[model samples]
Target: MKLKTLILAITFLATFNLFAQNTYVFLGSYNRDKTAEAIQVYQLDTLKGKLSKVTSAKDIINPSYLTLSPNGKYLYACTDTKTPNAGSVSSFEFNPENKSLTFLNKQSSGGENPVYVSIHKSGKWLVNANYTEGSVSVHPLLENGKIDSLAQNFQYMDGSTNKERQTRSHVHSAVFSPQNDYLFLPDLGVDKIRCYQFDENKKQPLVETKSPFTKTDLEAGPRHFTFHPNQKFGYCIEEMAGAISVYQYENGTLNKIQRIYTHPDKIKSGFESSDIHISPDGKFLYATNRGKENNIAIFSIDENGLLKNIGYQSTLGKHPRIFAIDESGKFLIATNVLTGNVVVFKRDQKTGMLKKTENKVKMENVSCVQIKRI
Candidate 1:
């Protein structure tokens, strides 16, 4: 009887693995003219790196940025006008089986144009960064994955040297540390990363850490940040200067170690760098450059967290605003807003490079791409 029971367990595990075949990729769009759905879902073929359209969430105006809950059962998005003093954050309950989203609730993002949202690893708190107003807000999550009332809000008043783009503070992204003990808010207009100690237990959850902030190069316009999986280093992609700043992170403090340019010296146009991400294995880093060089810049990370530029790949579309790699690192999807299409790329895991795939889908005003293994 014991032998029979062991065989049954092994058979069940094998069946489960066989049926888990696809991953869900969510694409968020700006929906400027309301002609396109705000959020579109697709099923990624794990083996072939192909994509098929799933259902989409409509009537969501300008859902520019999206974040999934830690459990993957919910999704949160920041929506509204890019102009100052308007916008909201919305929540949705996600169904893993059918890959569908049910709208849950929304709340004022506390400022204008909330461009980014991040959930705490503890699954109890949600944070948002408002770009136009240069502010941040914290909110609580309900038991059912719905967002509750706002908890705290803070605004930054300072600006940097760039008169055209840096006339005022512009908070672009807020990312929590690997341990969930700290939060980093990268301000594009001010050229600094605001460090905060995050404690969900307190009435005021986000407080200034021992090191309140770290200044990047003047006019750098730090836009997005990604932490190394090793938890020892972090990278901030600068928008205006088209550079990546590497830092050593320890207990909410950041020590700048290296800075690398994303574009070649000859290709000098107005800078419009967008996103940054590191591979799951912590071996490679990727940054997106938009202005004249519409490409994804690739870099290799060394043992000491320094970066070496490998090369750049054209996105094949205009304004590759955001892109995401699958968990298996087999494919990448780039959402190009100006071209109104999504492009798929096959990734060479051995050399950390990308090859354009034949697959392309037309989507209106695509802004962000996020992938989750189902």
Candidate 2:
């Protein structure tokens, strides 16, 4: 009887180990005006937070922005033609068994230069930011996970104070609040962060108490903003000034608390900011500086949610447009748009610093990185 019990215990342990080891990473790519280039898919191992290529050079248009469904069974990407005139988004059915993606369908984004895409928390709405048209649009997701025609669209009229880049309102990113109660849209052209209350029951969004939303410093040109996991603080990456502004947020209103330059003192040069992300632990914040300076600015968040400069790390490539921390917070992947390389970095959890890793993924004009678990 003792021998039989030992064998059954061993079998149960093996099954438990197998069930605990399931996870993956999905990468989205842009074609960069070339044919025969397809969206690349990679399998991310959860145990080590390492990425391995699963699908090579398959044909999918510009997969600019990628977001997974709340249920983790689907992936969606914004496919732009790379021209000012053509833009669309596509949905894919993700297969965990094969580590592959199957295209579902495509829908027009209702404006030119659709650069960013996001899904509502309720999984009922998909929002797009039309850069050239300076507008934001909402699409209803059908029961099958495909996007329908535009349900609502809004265009900004007041242009930015800066003429070169902000001659018109450029809607850059739209994101839903963690509670699914409000939607925040950051516009580069008008230098405004618009807030809207989303009614999941009615399938519509209403402007919040602030309505047209809050404005940053004139001509600050907010490109991206990220809310702290606690939802008490927010950070905005300003493209025009290459600075980050910290804000105290409560009940859908943002009160500016501090602003600081991403670049170190005496390094006076032109640089554009791309993305901002808060660490999973809510203890650190990171913002990417593209253009002349290709580095990431790091900051530490105090108990009060104020930001203090930690340091900066070179991405080891050009145009670090987007980057993401692995689900485990063990690794970070920075996409270099100009150099066409994705540089991997290991995270120092204690000091919130990133050290270059030996693993690097090479591709052409890579725009963004998204990771998931199977």
Candidate 3:
């Protein structure tokens, strides 16, 4: 009887341990022509929703955007540069035991100034957005989590209404549909979201009937977008207008449903928007506003996929370039580019609001933040 009781107690403790394990945050930096910038890592307590630093920030070149594999074992970042067109994607193996990263390999992004990276659902392909060269490329990923080679490349030729902002097409982000059957490329320069049918076996993207993608006003300058878990709705953050657009997505096609301002209707400030994200629970959407006004605008999504503005929270730092929510949906980390600080926010699941936490990590010209669990 004593041995049986001891075994039952051990089982209970093991179950609790699994439940208590939380996610870790990984931050990407821009470096901004400096020598090199570091990618910061932190562990977030799941039960308490608290953040603590893990590895000392390690320096790397301009890593603007980052993505983790489905298994959460590998991390990929886009290093943006102009000299020698040094645009590449670097891979790292994540060591969850120590909350550290081990460098794996690097691959050319196939264009200049690659700003964003997205991995396919199957973990077999990577899609990159080339900001300067105005193109998108798909690359095959090896089993070892390294980029094998470029599989497909598509260039944009058209320009948008805004001359200064859109002198030429600038592909800002490339994302795959939840089903992984289509790829969506948002071009800030052309104000359009280009769609391509993806072939996993062929490792290539072919234009679909819903091809050439959908346009977002002539010069709205869509920067980043996110889809709801239901896969029926999507949201886009417009950079030039500081607006959020809601769309209805069906059968590989998109139709604009609604558009709303990111800022208060009365506040007149010259601010540009940067990133947009949807909560894992599909209850809220958050967007970052930069420039003279720095804050994150929050919105509640209705059952019908409409967005109703909740409020805006000051990022507590400058140039909130990009931010991300942890896998558990317990914490949000906002990266301030100019001031070089990453601030943590406790997400109120009930209210769908963000409260600034006491923990803030300092770094240089931080561009993106990603979080994963062990």
Candidate 4:
């Protein structure tokens, strides 16, 4: 009787371990001119950092960026359309069991060339940024996780000192604060991080915050924003300047703390900073630099929200448009657009270093990657 009881306990533990090892990684691509699917699903072996193709969603034109719902049951993408100066957003119900997607609905993104999409923590709002037309839109989320019509949209008219790149306001990323009380829109063309008050209780959910906006350096085009888990600090990567600005965040206000260069030695040209992400443990930060340098810069965050440059990891491909660390922080995947491949790297938890793995998957014109455990 004792031996039989022990055998039953061991079998249950093995089953649970197997179930926990499976993770879903969704890759979004610039499929406008490529034959690859718009969204491809892969089953990631977290322990070994291996990816196996699961399924895909095709015919989506330029799903450049994607965001999973808070519950991981729905997925949203910025459908960067072929229409001149206009684009839209799409919502899909994600089936984790089968690793498939069901198209729910689509709506105009309220501007042109939508580049980024982020869902609110409360699952009540979906916000997107349009790069070409310099606008951001906020759409409401329905009970079924479908996106409703645009609730509020704002256009920025300011431009920075760079004549070529900053000719018009170009909203690059729309990210919410950790507390979900504020929305930060990093405008690459205007060199300003626009802050807005977000109230999900209201029909028009987004409004200008008390301070309105904060300015970056004259030509420092802020492209993306990420908040520390503590909610006390924020970071924005400058696209044109190739630098990261650290800010002290409190109640919709951003106080610039420090601005550091992403490269070892700055180049006169060819610096287009792409994405920024913080580790789940809130101990390290990573930012990508495109153009001449195809690498991800790593930094260690101190207790005072200051950053110390650690090292850089080669992305192994050209134009690493977007990269994401898994929920467990054990794996990092970089989607290279020019090389048409996604490279997975194993992360060192203690030192926050990334070691390249042998796993590489080919997806034509891949632009974005998002991973979650389900």
Between candidates 2 and 4, which one is better according to TM-score?
Answer: 4
- Looking at model 3, report the run of 10 residues with the lowest lDDT sum: 203-212
- Each candidate structure's TM-score, on Cα atoms with residue i matched to residue i, is 0.95, 0.91, 0.92, 0.93
| lDDT head-to-head 1 vs 4, winner | 4
Candidate 1 to truth, TM? 0.95
| Model 1 residue 82 CA deviation in Å | 1.5
lDDT (tens digit, per residue) of candidate 3 on 73-114:
889989755435678887888877876688788888989999
Expressed as tens digits, the lDDT of each residue in 1-374 for candidate 1 is: 99999999999999988676458888898886455688888888877777898788876689989989877788899988474567889999888676578899999998999999999988889999999989999999998988888899999899998889899999999999889889999999899999899998986799876678999999999999999999999999998889999999888888999999998888777658899988888889988989788899999999999999999999998999889988888888888889888988888888899999888888888889899875
Off by over 4 Å in 1: 1-21, 33-35
Query: lDDT order of candidates, best first?
Result: 4, 1, 3, 2
lDDT of 2 by residue, 208-302 (tens): 46555888898788888888899888888988888898889877778998999888786666788889888889888889998778999999999
Q: On residues 1-374, what C-alpha lDDT tens digit does candidate 4 reach at each position?
A: 99999999999999998676568899988788435578998989888989999888876688988999888889999996545876999999888676678888889999989999999998989999999989999999998988998888898887888889898999999999888888999999988998899888999989776687899998998998999989999999998888999999889999999999887785667768888999999999999988888999999999999999999999999998899999899999998999999999999989999999999899988989999887
Name the lDDT value of residue 106 in candidate 3: 82
Clashes of each: 0, 4, 1, 0
Instruction: Choose 1 or 4, whichever is better by TM-score.
Output: 1
| RMSD per model, one decimal | 1.8, 3.4, 2.9, 3.2
Q: State each model's CA lDDT, in order.
A: 0.88, 0.79, 0.84, 0.89
